[model samples]
Target chain A: MAIDPPYLLFLGDAADELAAKTARGVAHWRPDRCLGQVRLPGCKADLGLPDKTIDQGAAEGARSVVVGVANRGGVISEAWTDALERALDAGMDVAAGLHARLNDVPRLAEAAARNGRRLHDVRHPTRQFSVADGKTRPGKRLLTVGTDCSVGKMYTSLALDAELKRREVDADFRATGQTGILICGEGVSVDAVVADFISGAAEWLTPANEPDHWDVVEGQGSLFHVSFAGVSLGLLHGSQPDALVLCHEPTREHMRGLPTYGLPTLADTIARNEELARLTNPAVATVGVAVNTAAMDAGAARRYLRETEDALGLPAVDPVRDGVARLVDVLP
Target chain B: MAIDPPYLLFLGDAADELAAKTARGVAHWRPDRCLGQVRLPGCKADLGLPDKTIDQGAAEGARSVVVGVANRGGVISEAWTDALERALDAGMDVAAGLHARLNDVPRLAEAAARNGRRLHDVRHPTRQFSVADGKTRPGKRLLTVGTDCSVGKMYTSLALDAELKRREVDADFRATGQTGILICGEGVSVDAVVADFISGAAEWLTPANEPDHWDVVEGQGSLFHVSFAGVSLGLLHGSQPDALVLCHEPTREHMRGLPTYGLPTLADTIARNEELARLTNPAVATVGVAVNTAAMDAGAARRYLRETEDALGLPAVDPVRDGVARLVDVLP
Candidate 1:
């Protein structure tokens, strides 16, 4: 019998041996290619082959490829991104470790999208299909939200998680990058994969998953695409969240230089929230303000909020004080 | 004489020729070198220099520096920052046109500080400043506060000016950068330069020039040194103001990565305001929040305000609605 082609797995230096073997199993099934391992400098010990010559192995038509990476903490550097992009361009289906939170996935996806390549989720991989329900079913109440770069999204997510846990709510706050996989499955940092996993897990746990057993997945950035770009929307569409909370500040100067959606004043901000509510059709929820009190005095801030409330018909909460538990109550 | 060594004025394309010339005047005063005019690309303009030329310029002597960026929109570009850093390292004191907004200046300052250089303020040719007793002070009752960025500061300052004028108060806002020059005779950006010029003008316009007029000067940025590395305490020791209004966000998440001196909470934020009040010993004046309300409902926002007020002892005001008018009322 002709020798079966070996499977190849490409990863950062952090994958463990079992993960590599699991990847190898996926590779072993490929008919045309044999599993050939090419380990770079930083390949994780769990993934086996370390420092294998990648260039030489590729020249030999390694049928299957597996790339491994070590856990270096935080977001993958640009250098790693460039290397991964190069590997993808070379016709390798990249399986990245979902060790880092999903914060940088949108950026990576944007980069990949620019290159006309799609990143796939190695864990719970599935086909794309539209849901008949038209609304994402909320399985785990976990949610993550953040801004493009420095908009305090991670802090908000983490704080929400901490707050939820404090309230004795079985909330699982997973950062979409590093902290995500630990809470979910051993899925790579592929956003699609994560979303699929989330959706699948929600389906699997539904009815059985108590409302208190909420999975509060923290989003990486702002609502209007940017940080995780279309991921949040995609997640919302796929999962059909029960409620959406927006964290906002109410100042013209703060809103300045930002992409204007006709939301300049507190009144305008509320109007925009309504518009978002109408668009997403999710149970429109309360708005949360991460007020930087050090920046403003209490009385002045109260007056401003009062005026803003008078303008907008809904309620608002401070994420720091009221916490996520209160947010859950306020959310429809 | 040898044409006064051909004075050179470096500027971004957005600067008015008159302003450029005025900036060059400062350079002209330094007799040691031949001035070579170097024009930078404005935020909206294309970078005229080729990459090779920029590289060469960066490699050249530090004294052959360029000055004058009208806006920071393009300052973050590698080519611009690298070349500018190179020029500054080659021994040039960069005097650029900065916006009078608080948010604008700090970024510029941060960038410059990153390269171990400081942005200098160019005095406006026609502004004035003067001091008045408690009765004649512009912010006598309302403590006029200023922030650091180039754009936000200017907007706030101008808005305050408009508000005071609307209230028919004998109040005037002075740029502290300009006042610095008056006290010391030199600085960068319009505010400081204007402050300096006004200070000089105040002297020139004293009983000797116009002794009856009192001036309220506004400064840029916080007294604390905020940079990529971290926030430093006592960055604004000698440069402290009579009364200060600090801007901050109240979310713990927002404050997480930030270098703060106090606990990270709404209450902490409030306490910090009091701390600032105690530290500056300035009348714990009006507090402001540069809010963005696009994500929340107005009613909830109002409650948030009440909560914040209950937390902090001081009162808050919306800069857009009540800030300017209150400042006018507070003016002595």
Candidate 2:
């Protein structure tokens, strides 16, 4: 429970291979709270963080060490375990988003316990959820939908939440996946729930009657993605947002795992998402776009953003790079 | 386990309101095995089963009493429990599709045990399922998809299965819901599975590499039904059907819960389902239409079928009224 901030990221040798999805999420939303990144040799992506050794990071007031890269099969390598132990020995708490629990590894658990530090496993569901009954909720809801998976749903939602807070607007970010759970400290892994209860998990994440507040919900798989469409639809119905922000990764060529299906254009995505949202709330509207320009150059990213904004006639931004302020301002 | 059945259907008073879904399913697939119907005076829809009292049904060789109607909330009523007790006292096994388990009710369980009869709770999952790997299977898969909830998905699947058997074709029916579970005698309720494992449940139901047999998967909720779209998509991906049979009710005014969203035309439904099925298998096709003309008059039903057949240019049949022989012949 004592999961205070000032975190050191353990990207280690895995940084070059995997996307470091979890670390990127934390850096995007709580940049100032991050102390530095620790990587082994050949860690290519800068991730906009100052490189620091485990001792230097701990000495510089880092209270926790986060295993930030989401490796395939969620496995923690022996090298990563050594780095985690070094951080634990330095009296820092340890947190992970991997399916392989850090607590289950006796060495990691013992190291943490010896230092009187807690271990946080964020992918595990922290509470039970009821079935969604499709009832109308009270407070204004904002959902971030993507044209493809792993675009920028969590980052956009958190950026919007941060922007709203900066503008003195009452807003909250609700996470629905593993990485989001690591960043937000709480969430139901909607994909892990029973099919009948997926909507209920969505509904419980954003309850009705929050006075003047806005719930910026992180979306999951795309409705067009063959592998995870059910999870996508459940989250869509559960959020029942009054306004939506469509997220698109400009470089992806086709839907994930479904090479036969092409990605929908921004216009197609907006129309498709709005049609789904309207199933639960007739007045649901598309407010803006959150374009992921991670794979594009500065000029191309800006040009693409401008063209998308002009074509769709809506505010568009790389939520992490340009911030979601313009998108937040458009919220009604 | 010894659930031999010359079924005594407990229609009770619900027969006037809700259809005897379970009984109708059994009768459609195995009518010769059903002993008769037991109704509380004024019970109308004959379901083509002979009417018999509890004592009469037992004397005539009824070995099981089936709780037929899918009651609201799946709750077993006191009156229905009394009938179940009478059947047990007469040495007949009791089977139900209710969410409430017969084993959980001590009196029912005790009565059945005293008479050396078994209690069957069909809706509960009978097997564990692995996660879907999205691997292509060898045998062709055919899934029955509906335009709305409860538009006779099970009936269509069973009818096609029967037609294939009559033609001496190698085909198997795989159930995904409660009623289908009762008729098929075994299946994991896909809706009850975790969202991440829905596809896995589908994979386990019909594994790949069947040299010649066709798997007829029974679908659940519609892709457009807001409350249950997740279940629908999961079933679709899991089946990876080579061909899809679109089920539609001729008289449904709106898409289930969304009063504002109208039903898609037959052409639209076919196009939409094929697109989804193609996500996994590009060669997916729509072979026929299964029209539910249950609420129409005899002459009107025939006309509607003829018109739909002409408009779609596909084999169209009332799976229950006209059988699925023509539709089966169209499958590749």
Candidate 3:
């Protein structure tokens, strides 16, 4: 689902800055796509962008209004209805990554319909997909896999895409989750898709490209995650990545919500992921490792990266601290 | 998801006996659930049960009218609406596994609501599911892992459940697909579930039971099948099976729909499935092999079974030809 930009980022009455994480991500990664911020009167969050009302954003040529705030329950609150309707009336599409669909709201739906504007519920796929054919498609693809959920897969993927682009190599970051989707301006939330079509959805997201082009596909879940390994495996096969970047948050106690399962060792994670990935791409290689080192001191992070590189014989980097230049060097 | 039995089978204008495969499975496995078969004019399929109208079947204590025939495109035909309405009008619940949802049809919806009868779309899940907790629960589970889809995982599961029960062991067959749901009278079609909930749905299907009781789970897809490995992986983790019965169709040339891919070696299949299954059930073990020998002659079938057991050092049997007694004996 392509969400057109420049976007008017909605930070509707957020409780705090953290509630505007999604908006911040868009402003950080795709500033060119973001035009301005739209906040409710009592909103505590801010993206530090120019404040614009619906009419002002429309005048600025903003094509879409993104509900980028992460509300308490990922809902579209009643307080934001007026602004959303105004955006539609102003000839701007509305996109959201919320648990509640934008199109499901009666008032908003009627407004969008009246104005002939699209409502993109990015978390839910708006199109039907066939079961993955598993036929390898053309293009160089790199996928970010993790030892668990929320282990910097998206950040690593974005870094790779950015690094490859900086090197003047043709590349695209294929998002697979909500925040990633909002950041990329498009991508299917694979987890929301039917189980039968997980891989199929992945295949659709990173379709055939030039042989020299790199599709850095954002991964979802982890092969070791009990709650979501299925989504991970399907995405792995669907992406059919020629190169993989293993992502991990070293300080994580266990899989996010599954306390019973401990984090898998890096070696085990790589071996298992490569094994399953071989079903579609026999030449699939783990090019590098990206660690979330925010929990560790600078010295500790450096030592951990060095030890990881030495032990696994693969380049390791903190995507946030160190750029992904070293990681891209080993791309298959 | 349970559609209470005894069921009045509905075979509306079926093209052939093969169209009634689901009904035949139920009648063959659980004849006690079969009260009568209902046929529309021109229906070529027959379960050989006593023919009855919807009103007559309901009068005979049939609690549900199951649309047991597989129509073209798995659709709920307008031609069959009258019978379905009559079933609900007669105070019996209506159930079907079709691409078109039962409740989506206005006529059927009206009839069902007017009569206060439930409409069961077995292909779609009716209840919301939480993500798999990955915590260990009581009860032993034996899951059938296949080398490809439609290689008799359901049949193997059912056979194992039957064999276990015959030995006076407490056991239940947990279905993970549409036919399996109909066969068991209640089970989720895990493939139709949202990708995020595949494992969660599996956990719900085979929930905690007595420590000694067994839940024989019917698996879907193959770890080697690119099209469906995700579903298979999620089901494996969710099942948390103590024992696994590897099911294979020796005559298959490639991973189901994927022409370019070949099947993985049984040794690799066992190793990978066991490696992943251990995440949820650390003591998980692959106990035996179930071979579908329908494509081979009796002598060749025997030879193949013998070769499989000799190669893997696992007891191998043809579920339909021989029983799953040996497989059950090796259960942990």
Candidate 4:
């Protein structure tokens, strides 16, 4: 997909917080589309995008102002609302993945209307889904599961998809979260689905009877993340992936939203994921690890990857930097 | 709660199928509330309630017709719609726990309004729920987890609650499914909730305060049931139960809906439930077992209970026949 020339990310006050997830995603995965980033006052963190205010983005030919950060609880903050209004006022269309609708905020709604800009909610899937019947298909299925939320499941899946495609393989990417929806443009936001239909969403994305094909399904919350494990388990069961890539960030010490809970060991995570996956497909296995070493320097990242690979007995790669060739090679 | 007078249960043609779940529940849990059962033409098996045609129920002073059979996938069949119409035409209020809303079925809705009768959709929750924070609650919480769907989680929880209440203990029954909701008149339908909010639904049902009391939470699907395991895990984490009662139907040989998958052993289930629960509350433990011996003879039932008790080293009881006193004795 070619970059939609010059995108502006509205991080507002949360540029350093959860919304920064989207900012980092855009900067790293779709840098060609980025113009620059916007941050609240005193927020000096580099999001890898060009630093541009709403007006500056408009002047730089940005057609869309993407709400880059994903807020916890998906609530729209007042700061975010203000940034969105400014973007709309500057003649740019707005896109948001937050659970709260941008059209519901009156000021932003009016600004978009007056400026003739469109509103897109990436989290609201457009298609209907049916309940999964746990049927087996012909193609190979690969899933990326993480140790915690925001641990680069999407990044790993995308990298794997890209790598496989570059090798002329018949591969497809299935996005599970909103940021992934924004990146891929055509995938279900599985987390936004009703619990009864979550597996259905997975089934819809990875259809049956695709012989000799590979589907790289992006994963969601960790199997141990108390906040959203239902989505995780549903995706795990629905995907019915025979092979899995364990995505982990070595620097994170605790589970998200549960400060008292430490991360499970790599061996435990692999075992747990495999066991859960095996509930549907008994032949399920963990073939590789996708190490998120974005926080580490080059040497440290390599060491972490090597250590993870040694500890878990799987091929490991920092997919974003080193490509997913190593991980793909281990697939059945 | 006293049984309301003269209830007619609509079994339609599903008397021998999924609706049998509801039929069994009503017969075993609240038989006094039932006046008779309705089945389609050529139907012969008794659902434990006095078999009555629509006209017979009306003549017998039935004030309400309950949609007793929970069809697989919660589909409202043509026969069911016809039965509902007759019940409404007879001026009887109708109650349904199916996923399909009677209010959404045009003929049923019109019949209900025309006859000035009420339609109750039990599975649709009436209240809002936020995401669970996994905070420690003051009072003790005991959850009844099952080995499979329709394994008597609700029956076990309700029985335990009643036994505790009989003993003058401050115990409240928390319902998680449709039949439980119909019986209790309140509680979230955990499976109907959006994937991300399943945990939140659990949190809202059982609040954090109230020391010295006990909350008996009815569980939903099993942790090993691939079709609905997400809902099961969410309930487990959200309830944050200190103690659990493992509910099982020993006669079932395979996992529900999955023909190839064998049932997890009792030891494995207890260990799995405890492990998942411990993620939220380390103090969590399985205290007892609720054996659903509905499919067995009394002699065989007692022997099975004794065998399970010996193997797991937990107090075991048929909540319906034996009462839950032995189970309650093991609570923390």
Name the runs in model 4 displaced over 4 angstroms.
A1-96, A102-120, A126-128, A209-211, B1-95, B102-120
Please give the lDDT score for candidate 4. 0.81
Instruction: Give the per-prediction TM-score of chain B.
Output: 0.39, 0.83, 0.98, 0.79
Residue-wise C-alpha lDDT for candidate 2, range A157-213, written one tens digit per residue: 888888898999888888888777767656778887778878888988899867688
- Backbone clashes in model 3, listed as residue pairs: none
Model 2 lDDT tens row, B15-53: 453468677777767777688888866565567678898
C-alpha local distance difference test of each model: 0.37, 0.81, 0.91, 0.81
TM-score of chain B as predicted in candidate 3: 0.98
Docking class of 1: incorrect
State the lDDT of candidate 1 residue by residue for B1-332, as single tens digits.
01112223345454455444434333433334433445555523223322223334444533334343344453333434554554445444444333342114444455556666534433333333321111112223212322222213333444555565666655444433432232223332221221112122222211211332233333343222111000001111111223333333333232122233222343433343344333223444444433222244666555655665565544444444345454344333
lDDT of 3 by residue, A1-332 (tens): 79999999999999899999999999999999999999999899978899998899999899999998877777889999999999999999999999999999999999999999999999999899889998889999999999998989888899889999999999999999999999988999999999999999999989998999999999889998999999999999999989989999999997898776789999999998998898789999999899999999999999999999999999999999998999988776
Q: Per-residue CA lDDT of candidate 4, range A1-332, in tens? A: 11144678777766355447776776776677777887777564567566787888898789887777755678878767777888788888887778888888889889988988877777876566777667776788999998898888888998888889888989988877778766654577877777778877887788874677899999999888888888899899889998999999999988888887788888889999998888778899999988888889999998888887787778988877898899888788
lDDT measured at residue A214 in model 2 versus the true structure, 0 to 100: 95
Please rank every candidate by DockQ, starting with the best: 3, 4, 2, 1
Question: Poorest 10 consecutive residues of model 1 chain A by lDDT?
Answer: A221-230
Measured by TM-score, the strongest candidate is: 3
TM-score of chain B of 2: 0.83
Off by over 4 Å in 2: A1-131, A210-212, A253-264, A310-314, B1-24, B27-136, B209-212, B251-268, B282-285, B310-315
**How displaced is residue B9 in candidate 3, in Å?**
1.1
lDDT of 2: 0.81
Q: After superposition, how far is residue A292 of candidate 4 from its true place, in Å?
A: 2.3
